[model samples]
Target: MTRASRFRSLALAAVCLVLFSVLGYAVTGDRAPLDSFDVEGRNLEDWADDSRAFIDVLRVVEHLFATVGMTVLTVVLVLGLLLRRQRWAALLALVVMVATSLSTSALKVWLGRDRPEWQGTDFSPLSSYSFPSGHASSTAAYACLLVTLLVLFVRRASLRRLGIVLVVAWWLLVCLDRVLLGRHYPTDVIAGSLLGIGIFALGLALVDPRPRSTAAHAEPLPEVYASERRVAVILNPIKVEDVGQFRSVVSAMARESGWSEPTWQYTTVEDPGTGMAEKAAVSGADLVIVCGGDGTVREVCAELAGTGIPVGIIPAGTGNLLARNLDVPLYLRSAIDVALNGQDRAIDLVRVGGDGIEDTHFMVMAGMGFDAAIMEGVNEDIKKKIGWVAYVVSGLRSLMFPAIKVEIQVDDGEPTTHRARTVVVGNVGFLQAGMPLLPDATLDDGILDVVIIHPRQFLSWITVAMRVLRKSPIVDETLDRRTGSRVRIKASTDTPRQLDGDSVGEGRELWMECIHGRLLVRVPR
Candidate 1:
């Protein structure tokens, strides 16, 4: 995470804790507002305290899931991570668990407030400080950790959402149990939840630092290697820490392969890489190596499309969709090796125009509606912190984004209108999450694959998610699909749009056509 963003989250956490502390002081002084609410809540509970059955049930839930149950769940989660060979993740969980427990205890001791002495039938005897309910704090803490872990570790959308729902429900039930059992006031539970959240935000920075580690696989091999001689590399300086080191690596590899010292071009925020790529092709470069994210790669690929010069990719982005589809290694060393020694393969590129985007190209997919909303709404700070987990967070937030009515027309076919949450056009099947969004789509297929999702309800998304996960052949009205070389879509309104995860301004119409085997890219042997 960036220092400024980290500071903002930390400041928010600190503000919450300070607000809770002030409330604790005011409650001790029997001040207005908080004290008034607490006393009123106590009186209401006393007036409504008739059923021992519900209280007994709540007590049972508290006893089963509080201290011991929480500890057991933590152990099991950590053990599961360890079994999965995620030692870093397991260690992180352990640290956060211990930190949360100790911090909660310390806060409780510091506050040193007594439990409610109301006229209600209290199910359990509590002889400890109650300014912050330990049960509520611990439960919330567990929920935060487990959800974050799920967002980070779980790849399947269905399983991740299910796990999050179950975890959150378990904790919410625990909070209700504490409040209903008359062990804590509403203020105490609220404070506890805030404290848990604060600790979680803090732990994200302290326990596990930013820029988390990614697995490094062995260097990959390339197919037939032939160099007509000259090479040029378009580099994105912001994407790498030490640009000199990357350049040195490329130079050493290129020299080993009997190629001349490469012509280096740096991409700027204003001009990503297109102009440089064109210049390289015009200067008779046999190969153009792009060492940057998808945006840079897209620009270079689009610029050199029909020049017969192969483009080598060195992926440095979070969602390197094109590289992933091309079976290119992600590691810098391996990707450089492939760029220097790999064979060229012809692949299809989808050209998308209109809808505020003029004559742009997407080697992966073009999406509108819900998918575009996700790309447009993803939090920049969170994305820097947790990588793809940021997408999950954005996606969850955008699930309720209104659907759009779109008329899709394939080549020489009649237009069909549907209320769709998203309409995606793809040249490749697998998504960045490895979900086969268009199972039958292939880069060299010489056609475009389309999928339209129209979930009847929010829960119906599970059915769509399952279908994608299983690569089901079930194509019905809600999950309709079509394919053609040319596709024209007109939305009912000017909707958000994206070409390979990059947002194109809102537009009502999108015209796209596929160019088969139009570009050459390097891939693993």
Candidate 2:
């Protein structure tokens, strides 16, 4: 049968299983469950208990395999990326398998709310009150998943039959194991098995169960703990360097506020703090805070663009561009306290693209030409020694240099050509170390603040220098100060650009836009 046809069949089967589990639970949840068979037949309870010995071993395997539901699903997807083959059948099978198993678990918990007479410490391992056994459900799901895979992916009938035989045996044993161990009644095991079977059938309804490629193999990690609510922090210890102090303060504050001790994860430059933050999101972090300079904040911000988790920033870098804009306290104590007590505020992020493809999310501003030029020139050592003074030295050097000509367009608006020293696009106006770059830029505001500087004589250059140094807004008849949601600029000439203070590859044509009201921050109320 075609994979789609098979998937459709599997889906129907899964629906039947869910209906069976639900209707089955609603009718049988309060009854004796299986004692009627013992009363009608011979003394089979003892016999059934002994039958669980082999079933327990199979139970372990069933749990292990079932836990990898999502991993297996991903394997099916990534396999398609790596190889082109009849893989959808295999994908369909696993999908049904996982769906049924999850449904069965949910049903078990839902029914378990009402305690049955058979429930006690003897069945403690089979937790969540249990109307249908998760093990039995998993056994049924994986049995069907494996059989479907073999039938659809394997060319040889012998191999398919062998897989089918093994799966059916394990599935049966897993169910029998639960029954014999007294962990579940016969009805519970039977219901779970049926649900698994149904989900497997649903997969047949969705896609074919065939191994499309070697890449389809997935190794799921071991689950360490069980908690519905959790948080993970991936940061540079150097950024939060006084870990001893930071922890003590956060712990005390959290204790006072009724929050548990937060998990701390360190991220290296090699792995990038942003990637670690993404892992944190997948692992179920409710709120994430980053402690670093503009680059670290920007990197993590890129990953968290649409996650809706308010990112708390503890600025430790020399520039602290975003930190400055947000009015985040620079000292370690204030930063930590702000993270603990700050209210969540949403902000806009600017994206700049051009050249050999520089993709960056900027919280402070995007700069082209002189500002970008000076940014590239200043080294970390200079910044550490002289702080924002390094920018002054480089800015002066850049001011003396030739002007960069560029075409500036704003959100499908008219394109204007200009000769400038530098162009700045601000999301939240700020420069280095708590210095406000755009005085009127607000975090909650929905518009981007744009500034363009035109080159001039030495006297004019000095005026620009004084204007920037004295923190002038720099709006004039010639300079561009426009507000728009989307801004497009093409390099009339090749120019260097810096985003959120980090220098990216130069680009001539670029589209910069605000991902409006998307950032969530933990700021004080």
Candidate 3:
């Protein structure tokens, strides 16, 4: 461990010591448990009867596993980080596990209070300690550790806020469980929680912080906008029925942000996200804000590939998956706000083709199965009737759609064949809410996520729907995953294609390859 790690560990240990010491001496006067000393406590039998359930559950877990749940949770987090190659994540997990264990063990042991024995229950084993619950300690410690890791690594500010909410919720649930299970008094659990948090924070203070990758430098001089910085707002006017309306909004937003009038581009179904982005580059726009839906973003992103012109999103089309995934504000105002002030995040884009032959780039995903078919079939008439829920009604309409034959060649992986409805390729997870459609999908690491869904029945459609809605990995006995820096997809027939949300006309045989990460995005800090 480095100096930071050592100090962090010691800090946690020190906080634990101080809190335990104060609680040991000031509160409850360090009383021993009734069972340990054979001391008679008022209402001892009642307390014993109430805590029976909690002890039983703990005993069950102990019987099945030698150690408590802390180690298992630690393993889970460690394995996740390990698989993801997130070294910092592993260290943070270790810190949380240690902090939780130490606080739980030391706090109660030092209290020297006797366990409550209401009935003929065996309080014989642990009678002396009572004030603090090991369960509460473990719960608080585990949850706090998890939250700490999220806070340290997760990029989106709103998501970090959500993680904070989730951690607090976990704490509440754990506290309630302990009280209802009669394991500890509400006050005891509360104290244990405080100790857990302190210990974790102390632990955190020790680990060396990763050098800020995009730390803000000196504040900029007060100016409406960087006059030197040129901007081009590329848009897919064809996305909405009225490009005129979307244009008015984009033009106004650009001027308000003190940016030069942007050169507008409308992508046609014939030539979606391609060429147009390159057009932005040629124009020398310092910043490129894409105002259409996911398809337009993908196109703009494709062209912005290699060029460091920071891209922004003004999501207008259906299924703003990338925008949702990036946590770009849904409302135009919030989107514009972030477009103007948000931290710029660099995300990977998959260029699915070799040097010239019919190549495509995607920011959300790329697949060739039922999902692809849905994207191809979705029409504006249906989309206008319903926003994203169109997937449900449209999906039902697409049940009769036949599967197409395709050959997939993953990097260094064997070619696999699948007869499916549509192959949906993804760069980010949420196909709809932009929730993480792929839990494993990270915007930074340069790799494409290929989801192969083999839904055999109507029930299968439900399963896919659930997968998209949940924004989690949908793995089953039948689901296959192919991950690589590049992928080549060849279809026997001209299958329907869509990038982002807009349809990318049909193609008979096409190849898809990943660009190995290279997209500049304008985001908030």
Best by lDDT: 1
Ranking by lDDT: 1, 2, 3
Q: Which model scores highest in TM-score? A: 1
For residues 40-96, what per-residue lDDT tens digits would candidate 3 score against the true structure? Answer: 232433454556686576455433332345577678878877664456557766776
Q: Which portions of model 3 show Cα errors greater than 4 Å?
A: 1-227, 237-279, 354-357, 403-406, 434-436, 463-477, 490-495, 505-510
Query: What TM-score should be assigned to candidate 2?
Result: 0.53
My TM-score estimates for the predictions, one after another, are 0.60, 0.53, 0.51
Across 275-386, the per-residue lDDT of candidate 1 in tens digits comes to 9998998998988999887888889999999888989999887788888888776656667777767777899888889856678888888888999999999887776555
Residue 9 lDDT in model 2?
A: 82
TM-score of 1: 0.60
By lDDT, is 1 or 2 better? 1
By TM-score: ranked, best first? 1, 2, 3
lDDT on C-alpha atoms for all candidate structures: 0.80, 0.64, 0.63
* Model 2 misplacement above 4 A: 1-229, 240-244, 433-436, 465-478
lDDT of 2 by residue, 487-518 (tens): 87677667888887778757776677777787
